[model samples]
Target chain A: MNTIALLPHQQSPAVELDYTTFQTLLRARMKQAPDREFLVFPETDRRFTYREFYEISVSAVDWVGRQVEQGGTVCIIFRNTPEFLAIFFGAVALGITVVPVNPDLAVPEIRFIVENSGSHSVFFDPDMKGKLVPLEAELPEVRFSPLADVSELPKVDVPAIEAQLPHVEMTTPAAIIYTSGTTGFPKGVILSHMNFLVDGKGIAEWFQLNADTRSLCILPLFHNNGLVVSLASALHAGGAIIMIDPKASLRSFWALVERYNATFTSVMPSILAAILALGSDGRPGYLKGIISGGQYLPPSLGKRFESRFGVPIFEGFGSTEATSYSCFQAYPAERRAPGSVGRVMPISEMKVVDENDMEVPDGTEGEICIRGANVAIGYHNLPELQALRFRNGWYHCGDYGSRSREGDYYFSSRKDDLIVKGGEKIYPAEIENVLCMYPEVTECATIGIDDAILGQEICAFARLKEQTLVTESELLAFCAQSLARFKQPKRIVIINHLGDMPELPKGPTKKILYRVLRDYYERRLANSQDPEGLKWVLGSQGGG
Target chain B: MTIPELYAALSPLAEQVLRIPQFDKTLTMMSTPSWDSLRHVQLLSAIEQKFGIEISGDDAFKLTSAEKLVQYLHRQTEGKPQA
Candidate 1:
């Protein structure tokens, strides 16, 4: 196994990790607390103790062993469920990398991931048979199996599979997580067992998580946030996880937390906004803190949620390439700086660099770079992208940010998201943060539209609260108070005005898709005679 | 309204909003992938619009299955004039 070479300054008082591979970790947990509740699937009302899950993993080994060899890759398509966890744990323990595809993606998108990752087989939910069965003929080399329950797997004696288990190493690839790329085909991020474990341990230590910590997982397991932050971190801390289907969990979010006595949960900012809009009122119960990331968390939304629910939100910063999160707001919520993503964790080193890759002084806007044991090996099958992103011995996170003199980091925007209007660079968050502060505005996103004179003109989309009416002119007038002339949006599209889009276009995790909004503009409003008054134009297009 | 009557009235709306071929008592968010959170909200909104009744946020999430939704609707429209 290749070890990460850490600089002297990067070293810290490390948390001791006794197990090298996932198999040993599960074995250790089973021996330590055989009957303790480890995994809970609230939707199906199923619970698995440590011993029960270990036995299920053994069965998974037997079933998967028949179809796939060690070092082979298999694609799994399932919502958050016990079967997904069982297969994931079993496959990783056997040194077979697992590729988890979002079951909601269209067939062509799913086929692209399966073929690109070179998965030997695809295990999916029986509910998805209608969507996936057709792909079987399209890709004859891949095996497709639909599983309704983990019990459907052929059972094997626990000791028999245990004796024949392969010698898995820490550097063995565990999962190839596909990022929802904004352009072109999505790239698969290859992460090793060490990558997951180290980042998981870092999160656990940073939050002071322990066996008493019960994480409510509302994020999809297909994403890195759900896998590394929720599942892997809880596993590293020997804590219990309450898993719920991300699609069906929003309405029941508070109820589930109270019912399960969940102390910690990770979610995107949109979840908080939805909860607030639903007007769900109740005590936070035993919930200690909420981890918000995977997208920018508007300061107004964060402050409102905290004031209303009395639960602190610990927003962090990271990408799929770096496991989950490399930094988070300080613990206890009160110690966190208001608008910052917080200090870099002890397990990783973070710095802001210029175009030449030289480290920049504090308070300078530049690309943020991370180097740590938790960083992924590289992107799968894209060597050019791998070399470009992973150059200089540091993974160049294509995000623009600045480090404060006090050591807190502030994320500005994506490197591509920088809007150069008349040569004045503007980050979308600056305008979005101001727009979201409006009383009726539930959520909003800002993007740059093509302009003849300025190269790129500012455009914004805002989703108003249900049953609320606010004119485009009124919102523009509101922006004029906070923003200068150039920074203000040239056109603001109220998503509610567009009859087809009840909410802003969002990914599966509910992050607003700015790219889709740009395309919408290019198609509908670019050459319109009246760009600001979109009501007639959208009406003509059958959208209003 | 009776349980069967409630189910009969809700069948078309559930089918329309969830975009499923059919709706049955066995259907649930866990069992039917089409009954996702977004569709769950739309289904509740359609029911509200059809019956002219407001479903509180507190009660909205608990109605995950067709059985639960039918029972909830029955309780909500027990003596009211159905739209």
Candidate 2:
């Protein structure tokens, strides 16, 4: 087994791993380029220069700092807006652990993360009042603040702000991003300030970002792609941030790119498909390329979008546990492998390993594991699980991919049957837990099936306690209450003859055979097979 | 295209992309949930393909509704010298 350590391009500057905290970096950039625009909203014709952004952020830090105890957790749930980033940077700048929650999540979902992270205070979008209002009574210990909009964030004249920058260590916990595992519930992934900076520097250097480069924040800030890859990278490079309102037009995206003169943007495969559907009509401005990740993008879609939009596409592979990305198509233009997730970034160590966590030979498909400055410490409060994941000094990514002899990596299978639908990760255990609650359900499993538009849509299989006791619609309705819209099964297959299907398909320990089920779904949903045939007695379309 | 012609051109897309049962000048992207940001983009894509005109990202927001988009399209074509 060999580790692939990518080298920085000769033209690319060395990644700065010396920055102790985000505040130090932000203040450094402010000193370097105070007059230059730091954050720009092209659609609204509003721009915040480095000095202005810093001053505004200074005020936010002051506001949030007073509310939380030293090193206590602060959660921010907002749409893609000025207030969101400001509060996020404010929290990190103060050395508080910021929890970035999906603003669209229902109160119960929000409650789950809030309780798990033990948030001392929460700052959410005003529009989320309906959902977050319940938390006022539900979690009485947690303080809440509703930022009206970006427009309302005051830019105060906070002159000696450096004196207020909190002292923080590189390994100090900075963020707790919630991710689901086999536990059927979201686990809090604790990331350090160094994790963000290390990944940011790697991404910035790889993407060739500098003072002139501007990146658009189209991905949600809750995801590392938006916060670290796009935002922190730009900030670290002394580049600019073009914050697009997430709900903005897809056709308008290219226009925004040109309008803002954005040099780089981060995207997902589904967003690429949408951009490709528009074809090559708009005159794109300064967009050099897109940093794509979350799900696999076939080279065909990459070719179509790049040729049509006249912008190159580079895919990356990483997760919350990796802080951002361990492997990406880095610089020099010439070393990019279009079909793969590119080579390991210079800052991290990557390799493929066997089921026992032993190193597998190069070119053989195995679980991809990474160890680096960017790798997260472990899940918060889950020591047993942490020991399992952090064995042999490597964070074992459950994803199955192989490193080529040439040093490039390719993703062969999703980790732990992860369903990536429209760039959102849905774990089978989360949905299966809900399905199991129904009295009629005896056993259940969930799998992902590829779709033309969305990268993959969810397909579920369940064995009922009584043969004809439950209807598909009834189970789907029950699921809708517990699951997010994206996680809801697009199709459900009933295993009427469960005994005939390989005697419930079990592994050595009598664990349900998930691999076998996923393979059967792949065969059943193959392009050559009649997908409808599986729906006859075998399947039914779930609610939405 | 005339106002009526513009309405006719957008009718099908309004149904397919936006699901506006009946589109009129009063119907804006803000008025319908279907035309929310994502669908507004799909609508813009359809309109650009339908008319073969390019709208800049800054200009896309100005085409807020059927009336504004049609008026803008008419202005562009009218600006063209008689070919």
Minimum summed lDDT over a 10-residue window in model 2 chain A is located at: A535-544
Error of 1 at A230 (Å): 1.0
lDDT of 1 by residue, A359-388 (tens): 999999999988787888888989888888
Q: Give all candidates' CA lDDT scores.
A: 0.80, 0.75
Docking class of 1: acceptable
- List ranges where model 1 is wrong by over 4 Å: A1-16, A417-544, B1-8, B15-36, B48-83
Residue A231 of model 2 has an lDDT of 85
TM-score of chain B in each prediction? 0.92, 0.82
Best by DockQ: 1
lDDT of 2 by residue, A202-261 (tens): 888877789998888888788777889888899889999887755564656767777678
Please report how far candidate 1 places residue A527 from its true position, in Å: 16
The collision pairs in model 2 are A255-B57
Question: After superposition, which runs of candidate 2 have C-alpha atoms over 4 Å from their true positions?
Answer: A1-16, A150-157, A280-282, A467-469, A497-509, A522-544, B1-83
